[model samples]
Target chain A: MRVIVRTVSELCITAGTLIVLFVAYVLFWTGVKADNEMHDQIDQLQRQWSASATVHPTTKASATAAAPAKPAAYHYGKPFAIMYIPRFGFTWNKPVLEGTGTDVLKKGLAHYARTAQLGQVGNFAVAGHRRTYGDPFLDFPKLRKGDAIVLTDGTTWFTYRIDKGPYKTVPTDVEVIDPVPRKSGYTRPGRYLTLTTCDPEWGHSHRLIVWAHLDSTQPVETGRPKALRR
Target chain B: MYGWIWRHLPGNAWVRALLSLVLVLAVVYVLFQYVFPWAEPLLPFNDVTVDNQ
Candidate 1:
């Protein structure tokens, strides 16, 4: 009988230790892993940018060109741009990949494939994790209207100014990513940006959405946009 | 159970304790490197996308 009690207590201790280790894995280990992945994605994009001259960098002469150049097709699961939110922090930036798949997000922010490409006429939607995986959007609730979200495609800088959210909505509200999201208070189609992240910081039962409009576009030859100048 | 392992280890008490510590460290390394990563996506906290993705 005494041996049985001892065995049970030993088993309980082992199980308890494992549970604690698992929690540590979720909180600390994943962050370390994701931080490495995000950096790798950024490095890959920068390398490609330097190696390839196919992408036409917008210049002062081309800024007023008659027609906007069509962006190249986005390759799936590939990092294509770097996004910055000064509101998040001066050093806050993440690689924006092509799709929102589970595997894609582990690297960095994901661009919803169905939406408009960055700086295009329609909506450009992106999603990032709010809690785990380096907590990329952990400060999501701190986003406010009029904040600027900037992106660079290794060619042009697209500065989008927030107009509508940090709006809260359910995950099923697929319409939130519409070109002119109705809840976002836009009347007609325009160059827009939608940032979506899981709500509650620690859960995904709801989503936090933010809407922005393309405020300005300039060539990378020019310095960082005014919104990011500080 | 830990007690059973301790009893069966082919060493004196001090040596047995050292072996047990090594075993625990090995288990932790495996959990951190392989098991945790494989299990992360299966858990719910990483679910950040909409549309059940």
Candidate 2:
């Protein structure tokens, strides 16, 4: 009996230690890894942009051009853009990767592949983790009406203005990412954006969504939009 | 349980202690690189997506 008790107790202690380690990984270790991964994604994007710039040598006219050139379809599991929300913080930004798969999100925010491309005339939907993987959207609830959610595709700075949410909804609300999301007050087809993250911080039983409208778009040479000036 | 492994491990007390430390580190590395990532998807906190079907 004594030996059995000792062995069981030792096993319990080991299990406890493992659980603690896992929690630390989830909360801190993952964040550290993800932060570096996101930075690398952004760095790769910047390098690509610079390389293309050297080849094409974008003129001042092209830099100021606001013509809506159709963006090509995004490749899966690739980093293509960077998103910045003034509401998140001045230095808070994340790389936007194509597809919302499990591995893609471990790097940063993942764009819903089925949704519209960035700043397009449709619902440009995106998703990010709320609590883990650096908590890209940890302060998602802090987003209010009129907040700015800006993004760049290495070409244009797309500024979107939040119209509604931090709206709490269940995971089944797939319509939230629709071209004209139901209850998002968007009755017509237009340039809209949707942001979704898990609710209650540490739980995934629910989702929190925010809807925003494309306010403006300008070439990257314009040197940051007014919304991002702050 | 640990006593058995300790007794079986070849080396003096100091060397045995170093080996135990290495063992712990190996376990941690495996857990972080493979085990945790495999198990992470099974956990609920990672379900940050919405599916339409």
Candidate 3:
């Protein structure tokens, strides 16, 4: 009888230890791995941007002459833009990668493939993790109605204003990314950006969304814009 | 169960300890690489969504 009790206690101890370790792996180790990978991706993007900058030193001149065209075709899982939220912080920046697949999200914010391209006439939607995997959007709730979401595709800086939301909705709310989102207060089609992340911080039960409108755009060679200056 | 495992592990104290350590590591590795990934979809991690209603 004593031996049976001892064995049961030992088994309980083992199970408890395993549970703790698993939690650590999910909440901590994944973040460490993701942070490392995101930094590496950011570095690779910067290198590519500099190389292209040298090749197209005349890009600014052409940009001023021509109407803003669609962004370059994005390869899946590739880092295409660097998103900066001034309201998040002065140093808050995240790489915007293509695709919302699980693998792509592990690296950084992902662009919803079905949505409009960045800085385009329609909605450009994006998704990121709220709790784990570096918790890129952990502070997403803090965004005010007029917050600035600045994005750069290594050539042009696009500034989007918080026109609506930090609205809460379920994950299946696909209409939120529509060309004219039904409840987003816009009646006509226009340039918009939407950011989505899991709500409640530690649970994936719902999604928190923030909608923004394209306020301005400028060539990168012209230096930082007034939105980023402050 | 503990007694059965202890009896089956043929070695001195150090050898038994090393073997137990390796077994624990193997279990952890399997859980992380295979079991976790397989079970992730069923967990409450990614199912949030609303249809076009």
Candidate 4:
């Protein structure tokens, strides 16, 4: 009878260990799988957008003109495409939205505030979660200075490279669009991209900022690398 | 002792191994088949409308 108890105790310990290990394995894979699946979906959406982007004869002419060209209308599969530090493997399809909704933000896309119009010249920005639900933006910190960000309208793809920051977070305010950081001599009248995420993964005490200036634009179909004229 | 564990072990080890396999299979089936799909609705971003560009 004592031997029976000892055997049972040993069995219980072994079973418990196996169970714990199985659960850990499942959870870890769950997160990893979710992240991969999310990126896959975003990549698919991007490819579809690129395939269907409108190519206009107006492109070559616009490139020659001094005036800034406007982006095509917001479309799914057609939000601005960004290729970040490929080293960080940052790629996402940020669908332009007129407002932030659970529907819009879930697919690794940005939801524009309703009041904000799509593709407007001033401080056009979008937001996403730092964690959970295939949180692709979870590692915005991994981005470094001089990293590239590309936004496209099917016909023309704009490239921007990170300028500076790991800067202090600012409150959501109009000043974010002043065409320059206030009180700084950094003002320039050209296209730019501003990326934001929660300061720390779990906390929102501050916001992390990444800013980049227009590097160049290219025709997706033409596949020619046209450097942005500064 | 190690030799005894590997060669002289009782049928209980096999039984426990089988039981562990079954438990893992069942848990995985439930998780992938039902729990994940059910929990997907809890994600902040889900329905994305792609506008024609």
Q: Which number leads on DockQ?
A: 1
- Could you give the C-alpha RMSD of every candidate to the true structure, in order shown? 2.3, 1.6, 2.7, 8.3
lDDT of 1 by residue, A27-111 (tens): 9888898899999999999989876645544343466312245679998899999999999899999999998898898899999
Model 3 stretches astray by more than 4 angstroms: A1-4, A65-67, B2-11, B47-53
Using TM-score as the measure, name the better of candidate 3 and candidate 4.
3
TM-scores of chain A across candidates = 0.94, 0.96, 0.95, 0.62
lDDT of 3 at B44: 54
Question: Across residues A86-110, which tens digit of lDDT does each residue of candidate 4 receive?
Answer: 4345344443333445544544446
10 residues in a row with least lDDT, candidate 2 chain A: A59-68
lDDT string, candidate 3, A78-140, tens digits:
999999998878887889998888888888888888788888889998888887778888898
DockQ per model, Cα = 0.69, 0.64, 0.36, 0.10
lDDT of each: 0.87, 0.88, 0.82, 0.51
The reply for model 1, stretches above 4 Å from the true place, is A53-61, A65-68, B11-15
Q: How many angstroms is residue A229 displaced in model 2 relative to the true structure, after the best TM-score fit? A: 1.2
Q: What is the lDDT of residue A198 in candidate 4?
A: 58
Candidate 2 lDDT tens digits, A65-102:
33456777899889988999988899999999999988
Model 4 lDDT on a 0 to 1 scale? 0.51
Lowest lDDT sum, 10 consecutive residues, model 4 chain A, at A111-120
lDDT of 4 at A217: 58
Best by TM-score: 2
Task: Single out the weakest 10-residue window by summed lDDT for candidate 1 chain A.
Answer: A58-67
